[model samples]
Structure formats: structure tokens, C-alpha cells
Target chain A: MGAVLLATILAIFTTMILALWRAIAGPSVYDTIVGVNVFGTKTVLLIALITYFSGNDDLIDVALVYALINFLAVIAVLKLIRQRDLAAAPEGGDD
Target chain B: MTELILDVVSGLLLLGGAAFAVIGGIGVMRFPDIFTRLHAGGITDTLAPLLIVGGLVLQSGFTLLTFKLLLILLFLLFTTPAASHATARAALVAGLQPVTRDSTDQKETRSSNS
Candidate 1:
């Protein structure tokens, strides 16, 4: 079981490296952002897997927090890119 | 016997999830444009976590830990699509055009003519 978990973690690491490559070499800003987003999601899974591997239940909370932060970070970045100002209203919306 | 069965099930789920994540990563890296990449990333954003965390939930059995695992999975399920949509919309609004078949065909014809 431990071996299986370890292998899963390693496989996720491979994916994270691939995503990092895209983040670095992606042709456009959104590509880079999406790559980073993928990387962060993998990180959350990795953390969760490690919790079971190491018998650290506490890490589960960390994984949950990480997921929340990852989602928020993506939305915030998208809003920034779209509006150029975070506080400004979206297009055709009442400000 | 039941424990062994559970272990096998979880192992298969974990391996399958890992495989999906790698495929998604490859797609994200190899796809030609942002829209295609977003589509690829959706695999990991959606299925990989579903399988992986579901396996973890099975392993944890009926404990509080199981609920926590499910919580994480649920949060991911709801947020990933929202994030993907926002990303695609932002890309479009920022003047990034998706590459369509017609556009590609036009480009190929123009190149051949040149």
C-alpha cells in the first residue's frame, strides 16, 4: 500500500514537472497561468497522498486549504487580467 | 480478505488517476493553443482528483478523515469548472483568438499560394 502511494506521488510529480514546463514555455499569458493552475491542483493531490503515506492526518487540512487558495488565486489572476483593475466592475455591469 | 480487497481497489484507482494526470499534463504541454490547453488541463482538474481522492476516501473508511477527503474532492469538483470558464473568458477578452479549423485551412492555403 505504501509502495502504491509512493508511486502515485511520483507520477504526480512527473505531471507537475510537465505543467511547470508549460508554465515556462507557454506562448501566451493565459497558457502560463493555466499551467500554473494545473501545477497547483496537482500539488493539492500530492499533499493529500503524502498525508496517508506518512500517517499525518494534519496534512489533510493543509491540502484543503491549498485547494481553496489555488482556486482563489486563479480567479483573482483572471479578474486582474480581464479588468486590469481588481476593484473595477466587469463589463456592462453597474459600478 | 476485505482489507486486501480494499487495498487492491484503492491501488487501481490511484494508478488510474495518476495516469490521467500525466495525460492531461502532456496535453497541456503539447496542445497548440490556449483553448486546447484549457481543455486538456480540464482532465486533471476534474477526473484525476476525483479518482485520487475517492481512492483516499475508500482507504480511510468511515472515519472523519473520509469526510475531510470528500470535502476536498467536492470543493475541487465545484471550483475547477468555474476556474476553467473564467480562464477561457479572460483569454477571449484579452484578445486571444482560438484556432479554428477554418482559420487553419485558410492559413494553409495562403502558405501554399505564397
Candidate 2:
């Protein structure tokens, strides 16, 4: 059981790496946002798994709160990006 | 005996969920643009946690902890698509062009340009 749990955690870690790669190497801001969102998701899963691995269910609340915050963060970022685009729309006649 | 079976089943679910997350990450990396990438990132990443939490809930048996985990899944299911939609809309408004595959659309645009 421990080995199985460890393997799952390792897989999630690999996922975080891939998401981090995209967040750093992505061509556009939106791509980076997408990466960050994916990263948050994996983090939530990691926390959940860790709880089971350690036999502590208390952290489920933490996972739930993180999920809430993750959603807010994504919306906040989109709001900021939209504002920036609106601000620059006047100067950028074509695009 | 039943508890042991539950753990093994949950373990398998955990692995399956992790695989889904990795695939979503790869999709984010390999997809051509923001819109297409969202198609991968939004759905799978949100769904991954649900499966994982469901698995954990199974392993934990029926308890308040299970409800807590379910709440997390509910939160994710509610939010991820909203984020995806906003991100796609923001990108489009910010001047990112989407990749189109249909040749007729291409020819129409070409004719319009010429």
C-alpha cells in the first residue's frame, strides 16, 4: 500500500513538472495561466493523497480551501489580463 | 478483507487520476493555442481531482471526511470551466489568433484577403 501510494505521488510530481515547464516556456500569457491552473489542480490532488498516505484526514479541509482559492486566483488573473488588454486596445489599432 | 480490497482499488484510482493530470499537462504543452489547450486543461485537470477524491473517499469509508472531499470536487467542477472560458475569452480579446483546420474556411479567408 505504501509503495502504491508513493508511485501515485511520484506521478503527480511529474505532472507538476510538466505544468511548471509550460508556465515557464509558454508562448502566451494565456498559456501560462493554463499551466498555473493545471499546477494548482495537481497540488490539490497531491495534498489529498498525502492525507491518505499519512492517515490524517484533517488536511481535507486544506485541500478544499485550496480549491476555492485556486478558482479565485484564475478569475482574478483573467480580470487583470482583460483590463490590461482594454487599456492597450487604444494604441494597438490592428491587433 | 474488504478494507484491503478498498485500499487497492483506491490506490488504482489514485494512479489513474495522476495519469490524467499528466496527460492534461502534456496537452497544455503540445496544443497549438490557448483555446485548444483549454479544451484539455480545463476538463481533465478538474475531473482528475474528482476521481482522486472519490477514490480517497472510498478508502476512508463513509465519514464526514468523505463529504469534505466531495466538497472539494464540487468546488473544482464549478470553477474550472469558468476559468477556462474566461481565459479563452481574454486571449481572444487580447489578440491571439486561433488555428483553424478547415480548408474551406482557409480558402474563404484567402479569397477575402486577395
Candidate 3:
């Protein structure tokens, strides 16, 4: 069971590396944001798995906090993107 | 025997999820535009995490930790799509074009606008 769990962790880590590549080389800003979001989710999963393997259930709380923060960061970034769009719109009655 | 079966099943699910995530990353890397990349990212963001959390829950048994993991999964399912939608909308508003199989629509729009 430990071996299987370790293998799962390793697979997830590899996936994270691939996601990092996407984040670094994505074609647009939003794609990069997507990469970041995926990374955060994986991090939460990794934390939870580690906690389970280590027999320290208390770490689940940390995973929860991380998830909450990740969600907020994504929201904030989206809001910033929206603000930027509003600022960039043509001033003359183009809408 | 039950424990062994559970472990194997969980392992397979975890592996499958990880594979999907990697495929998503590849799609993001290779896709021509932001919208398709967002599609790939969205898949991995929601499905992959859920699978992994599910696997962890199976392994965690009936414990507080399992409950927390389930909560995390629930939260992710609730939030990731909203985030992806907002980001995609923002990108569209900011003028990022979706790559299409044919250029006729783009040309028509551009000529019509001009």
C-alpha cells in the first residue's frame, strides 16, 4: 500500500512538472492563469495524500486552507483582468 | 482482501487522474490559443483533483481526514469552473481571439468592422 501511494505521489509530481511547463510557455495570459490554477489543485491533493501516508490527519486542515486561498487568488486575478479590460475599452460610445 | 482490492483500485484511479492532468498540460502547451488551453486546463483542474481526492478518501477510511478531503473536493468542484469561466470571459473581453479551423469567419468579421 505504501508503495502504491508513493507511486501515486510520484505520478502527481510529474504532472505538476508538465503543468509548470504549460504555465511558462502558454500562448496567452489566461492560459497561464489556468496553469496556475491546476498547480494549486495538485498541491492540495499532494498535501492531503502526504497527510494520509504520514498518519497525521491534522494536515488536512492545511489542505483546506490552501484550497480556500487558491480560490481567492484565482478570483482576484480574474477581477484584475476584468478591470484591465474596462480600462482598455474605447472611450467614445463604441459599446 | 478488501483492503488490497481498495488499494489497487485507488492506485489505478490516481494514475489515471495524473495521466489526464499531464495530457491537459500537453494540450495547453500545443493548443494554438488561449481558449483551447483554458479547456485543457479546466479539465485537469476539476477532474484530476477530484479523482486524486477520491483516491485519498478511499485510503483514508472513516476518519476526520477523509471528511476534510471530501470537503476539499467539493470546494474545488464548486469553484474551479467559476474561475475558469471568469478568466475565459476576461480574456475574450480583452480581445484574445479563439483559434478556428477556418479563417473565413475572422476575415469576414474584420472586413465588416472596417
Best by lDDT: 1
Candidate numbers, best lDDT first, in rank order: 1, 2, 3
lDDT of 1 by residue, B1-114 (tens): 999999999999999999999999999988778888999999998999989998888899899888888899999989998989888887776777777666447452111110
Off by over 4 Å in 2: A84-95, B103-114
For candidate 3, the TM-score is 0.83
- Give residue A53's error in model 1 in angstroms: 0.7
Give a tens-digit lDDT track for model 2, residues B1-114.
988889888888877887887787778777766778788786566667876787778876778988888887888888887888788877877777777777556432210110
What is each candidate's DockQ, to 2 decimals?
A: 0.63, 0.51, 0.47
Q: lDDT score, residue B55, model 3?
A: 79
Poorest 10 consecutive residues by lDDT, candidate 3 chain B? B105-114
Residue A69's lDDT in candidate 1: 99
* Candidate 2, residue B83: lDDT: 81
Answer with 2 or 3, whichever has the higher TM-score: 2
Candidate 3 chain A: minimum summed lDDT over ten consecutive residues — where?
Answer: A86-95
